[model samples]
Target: MATSSSTLPSLVVRMLRHGRLGPGLATLDLGTGAGGLAAYAARRLGDQHVTSIDVDPYLTEAASERLARMGLRPTFHAVDATAEIPGHYDRIVCTVAIRPGTGLRTVLGALHEGGRLVTTLAGTSLILTGWKHKTGELVGCIERGGAEFMLTRSGHDYPPALSELFAVASDEAGDETGTGRYPVMDVANAWEVRSMLEITTPGVQSRYSTHDRRRTLLLIHADGSWARAIGEWTDPPTVHQGGPRRLWDALERIRGRLNMEGALPLYGAHARVTPDGVVHLSRGQWSGSLGEE
Candidate 1:
């Protein structure tokens, strides 16, 4: 079971302020692991309109008890949000990241026509918010900042870690060695840049570290793709790429595109979710789409 129910204070404030959790709105807290957000919603929306759920019976029971200890009582259920969402709500806030098209539809179906939902996608840090429309679509924009939530789970634990793939990626002889076009930029720390790369070439994981005067950047993907770059602070680094995809090449291309455009696409972009739950994002002359599959 994913323990994503506890919304941190800063993010809670941000979501409440930026996500438009208006007064007296009936809200559903999807994946209520520790019931923090559920309790807050109960205080704001009244317990009658607050329904929290999780797939873990133990989590739901504990969360139910935790809410009662605060003298706040809202409905709690051990239900799969992607399979069975109980009642229609004016605001459905999900803590667990969901696959976009297929699983997202399940959450949208539980929202009232004018209601809204706030969530991030699995493996990326973009906080997406959407408003349900009478036309059977959800329209909104990505929040300026992002969040990472554990994916909702049906079983007690996730499938085995990707350690086996990582093992081969660590020391495999990469296919090419060349001078990097850009210096080892702070790719991982820069959320916007990292989020863009993750969106475009999904599943590439990155790490950065400094040893002596040299800076290193490592990229690995579950699909046997890997890249390594080593350079000084101001110099172009040497790069090696292995497996099928050119992981570092993808990052460099995205960097060039962003440098030319002068901005990240996460902010002020139009987000349109079709009936099938595909989220289309566009701004000015640029566009991107993310789907569950």
Candidate 2:
């Protein structure tokens, strides 16, 4: 049976044990994969307490076999987890990344009050664990580091490749371009921005270079956008960009405010999930959103 790295299973186990599951607690393992979690939990919490689900029948079969070998028997189901999760779970642990909108809402709804949820958001594999404080309110923080996993298959995966969207647009010709400075703040890091844009607009890519010449350019598009800059407050930047929004401008604005305020915060950012699977973020004066098929 396929299994996550030893470290992840161990970390997950640690987190589960910390949460302290016992008799009468229903545990659901979404995207059970090889059922390592189910097997582990069954051994700790008892076989009848664990129920695992995955979209692939092969994975389910493998997990069943693996768990049986471990001398534990847990119910296994093969169903599209993104569509619906059967029964409520006191502790719902998703081994896969969840898309925004309905998929996210569905998983959130599957938890009982005060139920614990540990899952990954798009862009980063860092686990985010939270408890249902109340209906419509889930609070959690991201765990340090990252993990790599296949995306849930029910929705659009990566945005289209960058090569597919490379084209000369008549409207882009002779558009005003200029150089600018971007002073990054504490919370808004380059990796986070790039990851967010890549997931939101997959076609967008970036290259950062700093040699004798210091420069930063943010390129964006329908597929997505990328930003690269150099000099790091040492020299002026030479910026060139071509896309729907002035990519450099957005970066500079975010950076400038962060520098002045001493913090670049995404927390409390207003988020709206559209029915068709789009995530919109708005906070105070800033607003942006992305759509996916």
Candidate 3:
């Protein structure tokens, strides 16, 4: 009951394309919300070769029941994926985003040698794919057209939400409001731009709204940082920001960089995650990292 039955057809197709599925190769689908990906895999790789797991018993039960009706029965487990899995697999595709340094090592341990695991990072929209080496590590990169998924969780519900951060952001007015150098840009809607902003500064959530014909973009972080921009995107918007950090300026800087470079930096970078879950990305001098979870 903690999950809804939903399917991103495009995401399923993209995941399958990069999953590297082959005949007779055992596959594991982690976080099987409604078993869409598992059923998709069952069609290509056969039900006997697929195993799907989720932390919610209701989800597992519902998925198992649905698959049975289709005459395709895949083994389903209502267990935590961050813990030791019941068996090994040739390919592990996680539908939920995994935080850096959080249970990624254990998931990799469940893969056979040279097996592939595809997942997105928790804080950013970077789809990472890696091959498990006999040396007990996974090396991969930011796949093209990155994905966003629900964060991997153990409990029935998400943690006490971002309400506190949003409350502060909605009320605070500390920094000066001035004409922005660039026209108001919808940064959150642009995937590449949003991904760059996220990787550069994690844990920032954005909310955009409109009231009485005027648009507003609000930026909030758990660290008491907040910023707001009000006006049309094509016009110079008034920006008000406060807290320990300059949030709007950071976004403007990224927009400026993208204007010069013609693209964001994260899409094609090489990613290397050690067993301890330290993620390093480098493509030329543009190197960055996601610290341990």
Cα lDDT listed for each candidate: 0.80, 0.59, 0.81
TM-score per prediction, in order, is 0.89, 0.65, 0.91
RMSD of each: 2.5, 6.0, 2.2
Ranked candidates (lDDT, high to low): 3, 1, 2
lDDT of 1 by residue, 54-173 (tens): 888898899888889989999998887768788888888878887777778788888899998888876567888888899989999887768767787766776655665555555666
Report model 2's TM-score to 2 decimal places: 0.65
Residues 233-283 of candidate 2: C-alpha lDDT, one tens digit per residue? 455554545545655566565556656876443444444443343555555
Better of 1 and 2 by lDDT: 1
Number of clashing pairs per prediction, in order? 1, 1, 0
- Tell me model 1's lDDT, rounded to 2 decimals: 0.80
TM-score ranking of the models: 3, 1, 2
Candidate No. with top TM-score: 3
Please, what are the lDDT tens digits per residue for candidate 3 over residues 233-270? 46778888888888888888889988998887788789
- Stretch of 10 with least lDDT, candidate 1: 1-10
